[model samples]
Target: MKRTVDVSFPVGPVHPCWKEPARVKCETRGEYVLRAEVELGYMKKGIERIMKGRPWQEVMFLAERVCGICSVVHNMVFIETMEKISGIAPAERAAYLRVVANELDRIQSHLLANFSYCYTIEHETLGMYLLDLREKVMDLLEKLTGARVNKAYMVPGGVRFDIGEETRHAILGSIPRIREETKRYRGMFSGGPMIGLRSKGVGILSREDAGRCHAVGPTARASGIAVDCRQRHPTYMKLGFSPVVRDEGDNFARVMVRFDEAIQSLSLVQQCLERLPEGPVLAGGICRAGETVHRGEAPRGELSYFVKTDEYGRIAEISIQTPSIMNIEAAAHYMMTGAVSLADVTSIFISADPCIACTER
Candidate 1:
């Protein structure tokens, strides 16, 4: 004779492990999560609703509020939407500037993720060191965009402000120094003896599962998907940038992918600085028209936007698909495939940088 037992466990907004307002409930008899459910829309601010009747130029400002960590990506999506509808294409200089901003944001975003991963496994000294090094990137962002959180440098037709001659030289000056520093920091954070033990075979994502689940960014890259939106559809095609990808599909692999990307972004910035052209930055003044869609690669993954405009230069409709939206589901696949502690699992979920506000909007 056999017997059956079922137990349900609740984890959420108030859980000691959580930093945000959301929950996951899992029912299980042993180590496996038999039934897992996600509770969402805790902080749904309805940003899209506010867009109705706002000017096309104003949408970038509104979209900037979607995600604090990756707001530059958000602004790009919104601006691209307006550009499509208005039939305006920015100058080559403007395009290069967008690439610079987007790539810089990638460096900051990847640093934060890898640093947090350092903290997750009890590598205290490395975590602190990585975080400190990350400050260099953050300070650069503040200087470039005025505010670190919502960098409104990307406007409808092109960049809002040009990189000044002095600032441009200063930025060029920092590249080699920042590159050497990041390379050294990356080595230190690898946590030689202890890290391998913790993450090497842990939380594996099989290549088949990775593709079937439609993973993106470093997550998908680690799992052996070569789909980088930047290369797939070149928003900055003139720069002739190539996508960086890898295969291993584990915690360590994901770390490598991000680390390489940061180095590559630094190199790209140098190229952009050298090739930074001089002309009117913007394409033209605002022109309101019908609806259109645009998509680009966010630091985390793919981001897309659709905006409808009326003759009055106001936002008639809007829709957005953030990488977080797709990656969140991929994360759920990881959680379901193996047994993981709440601690090892948390940051990757946030690492998706799921802007509940953007997805919910």
Candidate 2:
């Protein structure tokens, strides 16, 4: 059998559906997409190069700037790596507070990703609803960290500040509302006929493909790979964390996994607060000379930071592996291949939740 390409379709380096810039070239035969290729490098920031020779204090702030959506995880992973090298551990109370902040960040990020997917699929009403819920989560994040994005909350030994009693109560009180609304919106996304028709089986990435491509986060989890960096993190282990999984490996599955995880995050936040111990939030440790690698569960997937510090606690070398790198590759190749409609190309790409800023960083 022979398949002929009837047309070439190119999406982005700039597109309305995508917030960042990256180009995808699709070879198609009418409505059926035969192949797709991704091109990056439009938004490279050279952040790693900038961090070299800087002290840990400066690099910590730069780490969070890697991705605005999941900044907390970057800050956490970098600081934790430095702490490990320095043989410093945070107080138990501070550890729990870190988990609470990280989980809240996860919830807002998942909601934002799902909202983008909904908007891409032409479900504007559902998209708006998800964004509204995300705003509430952002409010909670602000309440905890004093900033919604790029929160430089985590430090070498612990966190920047302690969570006040009133902030704790406010976060606890808000979880139920966020969780219930997320559940209802997920129902709308899953049960709506038009949405189902557009997404249920669209952009399927098989488990084997997901594994071969090394997909991470919800992208891999949706394909039934039960890998989560949090599962190995000490604090998350203490809180009984588990990755959400689905067998569908479709756009719908990916979005649903995020929804499930968002709900799960709410529970994790509640657990952290209820079990939070009364103690000093800052353990106060210096970043001593060392080298270490650390991984954390960002909203998109696994985020890794490798750091080497000199005797003066200045960064001698640094490298960051963001989840978006593999997820974007998987989207452009495995997920976007085969008989996909032209209408679905952008939606399928967005489903993997590619972060161009993180990828080109």
Candidate 3:
């Protein structure tokens, strides 16, 4: 007996190609998607609940653990919040280093995301090429911060170490190669037919909707929202950075914006390196503290941290909201582009730079 109607697709909380655990249900009429439903495999880990009893200073790493890609941003958020609460700012030199590290972190994130974008678009060679470039940045991070994945370089008052001339020179050496490779790959991106076919006009989120939805980072910029935290936010003000906003609001636009932001981050790092001031890195800021909240730009979008302290730096309560969490709305919205194929959905997922670890922890 044949059924009059149809319903069923094998998708996953686990699938070979998909990195995160999520189930995708699609109503398909042959290869074309008719409808799609995404169910996150697990509830968010609820790490925010863990922050309540930790000391303000220690909570820095806790927040960083929320996502491997955005760990640096989380570290910054916690520190900035602590600074506000305690009424102590890092020395000028420290702030400069924070900017440098933050920029590098953002670069690493975009590199990884773009490579994954290529993977979903069936460009493994380009994906590997970009991944190779990203490795250099990761190596640079390991050298500077001593841990490749989490980095753990951010501490309460400021960054744990400064990038001195010798280290800076080494990092500077890698940039030219990075630029060359990026140029070559971007050439492929523009000329590749597959990338053109899969991404060009897909998942178009209009400019107004992007702003109305309050998207962040490349998403908002791709949609022409112009809400880059760097332009108006206080922490990034002195670092002197501007976002790479695009008006297309398509998959290609989102992908391109990530690449552009990576370049901008590199330029900002150069500026921060040149303008490095002279002073102690910590400024005796953490040992004495109170409580406060800070919201700043992360590679994904706006990151916020709230800290409460008593007489000692020990925290009474700590709460954080990484961009990826709020980023859910944008994903749901863009998904309306249709039953975005597993491939297209995955590509878009990478572009958003989700940090499950960051979001979870």
TM-score of each: 0.90, 0.97, 0.90
Q: Give the range where candidate 1 is weakest over 10 consecutive residues by summed lDDT.
A: 347-356
Q: Global CA lDDT of candidate 2, please?
A: 0.91
Candidate 1: residue 238 lDDT (0-100): 60
Model 3 clashes, total count: 6
Which candidate has the top score in TM-score?
Answer: 2
Model 2, 1-361: lDDT tens digits are: 3445678788887799999999998998878898888877898889999999998889989998988998999899898889989999998888999999999999999999999999999899999999999999999999999998988998877888999999999999988988899999989988999999999899999999999989999999999999999999998898888789999999999999999999999999999999999888888767789888888889999888888999889999999999999998889889989845888999999999989999989
**Rank list by TM-score:** 2, 1, 3
Q: List per-prediction Cα lDDT, in the order shown.
A: 0.72, 0.91, 0.72
Cα displacement (Å) at residue 287, model 2: 1.1
After superposing candidate 1 on the true structure, give the runs of residues whose Cα lies further than 4 Å from its correct spot: 1-5, 15-18, 232-235, 340-343, 347-357
Q: Each model's number of backbone clashes?
A: 0, 0, 6
Per-residue lDDT tens digits for candidate 1, residues 154-216, read 877788777788777877888898799788877764658677766665556777877776777
- Could you tell me which residue pairs clash in candidate 2? none
